[model samples]
Target chain A: DAGITQSPRHKVTETGTPVTLRCHQTENHRYMYWYRQDPGHGLRLIHYSYGVKDTDKGEVSDGYSVSRSKTEDFLLTLESATSSQTSVYFCATTGESNQPQHFGDGTRLSIL
Target chain B: AQRVTQPEKLLSVFKGAPVELKCNYSYSGSPELFWYVQYSRQRLQLLLRHISRESIKGFTADLNKGETSFHLKKPFAQEEDSAMYYCALGDTPLVFGKGTRLSVIA
Candidate 1:
């Protein structure tokens, strides 16, 4: 276990509603990442944080934002959810770039 | 941009048989390869990395730069080894493959 937990394991919401998913870790790793998983596409990066208040966009960052106020918590938000935005979001962290990452259970979000 | 590809979507083998799961990658720079596995109803977890040059759960993968492949292999398969396996590349933000589901039947 990497001491990671993602809140709201399952959620269903309507389009145009704002949604936030929380990822909490106890490992105090320096890197945190948010990824969305879909059939045939595998896992695509959404956003990542190298440190507190330091963030960057990934391959699929449009319509999504992330925040990292502390080393253990990274939050991903969708300003306005859409049906196309529905996906299984996974949170992962690692001590350094070369090391293997540890993943959270993931949050299943559905936008109607 | 780096990309990882697992050509096989599903693989099946009997217990005690050797198993191989193919993975290929495309990257311009030095590549860092890794294999991650997700068991039934379990969170995804790291299986092994090429940098370590070590085996996990009796499975080993060798990174072949010339072929741009990092195929995972094991001498003997067990039912417990059944899981979804993904191959990833890069250091910071790894690019993942679609994943292959391996089934080890008794």
Candidate 2:
């Protein structure tokens, strides 16, 4: 499990509202990622952080923003939630680029 | 660009029968492949990796560079193996297949 923890295991919010999902890791992994899982699209990366204050956009990062102020914390925020953003979000971390990632349980977010 | 493809959306096999989950990848350079499984409402867990060359949970995957494939296989399927399996390619941002749901019926 890599001591990964995702806060707000479940959340229901209305469209246009702001929502944030937090991922905390006990291990000081250098790479952290945020991904959303949907039925047919599989898991799409939203954003990732290589180090504290260093972030990059991913394939499906249009509506998502992320921040990492410390090595152990990564935050994903939806500026304004939309119905299409409803899905299960997962956080993963890896100590190195070639190592396998360890995942957090996931946060199920429903935007109605 | 790197991509992973899983042709089957769902597969059904009887207990004690052979099982194979196909995964094909498209990458120009050396690729690292992996198989991940997610049980009902659970987080995705790594099942096996091509480089490790080790069997995990009775599952093994051999990376066929000639074919650009990494397929997971097991001699006999068990009911407990029913889950959603994903094929992934390691890159700057990992690429994942849509996923295949394996159903082991008794």
Candidate 3:
């Protein structure tokens, strides 16, 4: 287990509202990722950060955005929440691509 | 596109029985394969990787290039081994399978 923590472990928000989930790492790894876990869909990458002020959209980045302004913090935000956006979110980080990515516990978010 | 496939959604076996969790992957070039496990109320953690060639807690995964598979096997499954197991692929950002839940009964 790596030193990763996700803020707001559980959240319930209404549709049309804005929400942000934060991931903080003490490992100082260069790569960071945000993924959403749904019942039959597995874990789909939503967004990832490679460096400070650098980020990339992943396969399922439709309604989410991510930012990495500092070494220890990575943020995933939903501009406007929707019911479809509800899922268990995960954060991971690694020193490089082929290395094992350590994961945080998870964040359970529900939008009603 | 890179993808991982885990055929079984759930499996059950008695303690001391042999266990196998199948995983297949698709990618253009050489890829790194891994198995991650999560117990109840615990974070997902790495179990093993193809590159390491080492077994953790009596579990081993062999990466077969021809079949594009990395299957986890253990001679005698323990009740503690019961958990949700995920197969993932990477050379870059990872792609994961839906995961298989193993239930071991005493």
Considering every candidate listed, which one attains the maximal TM-score? 2
Residue pair clashes in candidate 3 = none
TM-score of each: 0.92, 0.98, 0.96
lDDT of 2 by residue, A69-97 (tens): 99999999999999999999999999987
Return the TM-score for candidate 2, rounded to 2 decimals.
0.98
Ranked by DockQ, top first: 3, 2, 1
Please rank every candidate by lDDT, starting with the best: 2, 1, 3
Please write out the lDDT profile of model 3 over residues A7-51, one tens digit for every residue: 899999999999999999999899999999887787889999899
Q: Docking quality tier of candidate 1?
A: medium
| lDDT (Cα atoms) of all candidates against the true structure | 0.93, 0.94, 0.92
Model 3: CAPRI class = medium
Q: What is the lDDT of candidate 3?
A: 0.92
Between candidates 2 and 3, the one scoring higher on lDDT is: 2
Candidate achieving higher TM-score, 1 or 2: 2
In candidate 1, stretches whose alpha carbon ends up further than 4 angstroms from where it belongs are: none
